[model samples]
Target: MPAGRLVLRRAAMLFAALALVAVGVADGTGSAVTTKPFLPDAKFDYQIGGGYPPASGVRVVSRDVKDVPAGLGYDICYVNGFQTQPDENGADGQPLEGTSTWFAADASRKQLLLPNPTPEYPTSTENQRYSTPYYVDPGWPDEIIVDLRTRANRTTLAAIVGKQIQACADKKFDAVEVDNLDSFTRAYATLADRTSAREGTEPEEGAPTLMSKNDALAFAALLIAKAHSLGLAIAQKNTAELEGEGKAAGFDLAVVEECGATTECADYAEVWGGNWVDIEYTASGFSKACTSVKSTISVVRRDQDVTKQGSTGYVYAEC
Candidate 1:
């Protein structure tokens, strides 16, 4: 064998490896998985409720994981990645039992679920007695947190979400947006989120679940890897604080909600550049976001519910 031939063979192998990375394949290590990233600053819309023919020139749209995508340009399938879906209950208001049984605190008591505490059930006594499985977001009671405290749990969740991503791919969506990336801040904040949320009263027993930013980031890696392997880009929803880690974990874009309202647009912009989209729900926030980054980033003002164009409160303004 000649040295020149050996060098050519090695170079070919290297180029092949790089090509593999570009097409999105994952080996579990964050380094190997990469996707063809979506272009930055496209006209965008967030329509999680239901699909509609997108507005003229809209290049990106976000929809619920279960719903059909808008099919305009780059569709993002939205999944409640770090939390239980709000609609996970039977019509009777009890947790569903079959395939979607996200766990419950029954006599068996092995499932990782807390109570949906309220004024009457502040102590989680009645809520638990009724087997109401939840440790919900303070702002959105129906949205509950999932346990990402262990490797098994994280793997389980990743598989669950991976199926949702597969559905998006099956429908030909361009991307997936795993929402509630910041759920851990509430799930683990017993001192601040638990006690304080309960009117400064003593927190109930088993009040807080063991979810942390580290768990969320680790979990994001699983989702990112799964998305990339499917040749679909993944969005880092909210949690601008985790933007740096999320980017390193192979997140392809950012789907920010109220960054202008929270004054954290810069945090996301710093890492994602203009490859991020912002949805503002308030007039003031819309003004700020449009005034600041609209020239470079994709910014839109939408109704709080992201109502369809025909809905009464529907509002869509791009800046």
Candidate 2:
């Protein structure tokens, strides 16, 4: 063989050998990890508020942590991972059973750190209370944000929330949808700035600050590892900005709300590759999503409350 031809042949052989080794390494690492469940391109229902008999042709459904699976199709159990749900019992006003309690304490760890009293506004409602340790989100006054900055807090959260994901698997659900991944973004500083900008008022002071994006990511990674260990596929709920980080942290799919209305349907779709389920609350939003590239993204329109079918204000549509 010619010297030039011989040299080219050796180079080609070396490249092939390196390629084989790379493939072997990839297979070893990938196969050892649990594969995410396949999210079918079929009709899906987001019934987080309350469960109802799935409409005909619905192949997937997501319901609150307390609700049982629909038992007809793929089910995703929804768990509020980043914050505490409202106190179930109005009398005692205690945290919901089997969930994390959000209690802030001083550096001495003896006294509770109380939230500053929120000034009464014209729009304040009966259920909206401002004098508590919890920092009430502007729109969602019920959810008490949990602190995810400290390692101790994150560990406690993993123990409390990880059990919920485990329960989803125990209940035989197809996947788990961990909500409030972006709660950290709603921290005091960000919320105060946003609220002031929108309402044309001075920024609120004395708001308690908690988690950062990195903190949220770390907490999510813990939950994802726990979910995979239990053989359950976990989803990244909303928070389009963290989709890439969530994917890297082992989230299987995306559960997005109002992405279509916000013109962010393509963001989740790009990350999940049509493996996302988007729910828009308005008819116009649904229609717009249907016409966009998200047409094939399992887009649905549901009432803001997401009430069950046959109930008053029940609304559901699909693209």
Candidate 3:
């Protein structure tokens, strides 16, 4: 072979050798880990608020991380990853649960928590340990967005949240549904800023730091990686616009909210195929979703609050 052809051949051989190296979840335990995915297009139910016995044929159930596994199906533990999960009220000394009990309330963790951009804001302490008055997400005033603006902050928050995600794995949950991945979509400088957001666009970050869609995806990638490391499949929750980036980040599936109501279930279906789960809150939306999306992925209609069976206003339908 000519010198040039020989050099090209060697380069191609090197590239092929590199590609042959397996790309898989790195287990900190010194073994390669693999996540088990949920059955595609399985009968699904959302029990984020509370868990109950599945309504007959239900095969997949997602519930809040505070709850234990329902022990009946492919259980997914719901975790609020980008922001502090609203853990109703608990004093610091008394010990709270979830993120509120985690780093959010720590005054020193203000660096990890985003600054309250819009306020009757406090110049003083609000979360003696974890209240949103410090840097609460206005849309959900009780919740606070974590700082993902820097690598250091993301790393620190990942370590903190990863522990809780590991709990889901420990509880024998097969997967994790991480909510609030779109905090980057809304700029929460004030009450009005909350209403202003273009889908797929991260609101502009002003002074004290507001996250963008890119920031949200980056942080989500961390949690997804962590979940996989623990041998648990993780979900890309509700940010339809980020499905491509999310799949690239190794998310095993998606847990979508109101995709049916918004007439956007197809957006997720195109990407995740049968691995996505669609949730609807209205009858008309459910009907439409069943007609259009049910054949491709899981779809359900539940009460707006996602209450359990026998509760007043509880609604559960499957397609």
Best by TM-score: 3
Off by over 4 Å in 2: 1-36, 90-95, 98-132, 190-210
Pairs with backbone N, CA or C atoms under 3 Å apart (clashes), candidate 2: none
Q: After superposition, how far is residue 93 of candidate 1 from its true place, in Å?
A: 13
- Give model 3's TM-score versus the native structure: 0.79
- What does candidate 3's lDDT look like per residue over 137-195, in tens digits? 44455566677888888888888789889899989898998767766555454444443
TM agreement with the true structure for every prediction: 0.77, 0.76, 0.79
In order, what lDDT does every prediction score?
0.67, 0.63, 0.68
* Candidate number achieving the greatest lDDT relative to the actual structure: 3
Model 2 clash number:
0
Candidate 1, pairs of clashing residues: none
Cα lDDT of model 2 by residue, 53-83, tens digit: 8879888899887789997656889987776
Q: Write the per-residue lDDT of candidate 1 for residues 126-218, one digit (tens) a residue.
A: 233322445655555545566677778788778877888888878878789887887766553443546454343433433554576788888
Give the least accurate 10-residue stretch of model 3, judged by summed lDDT.
1-10
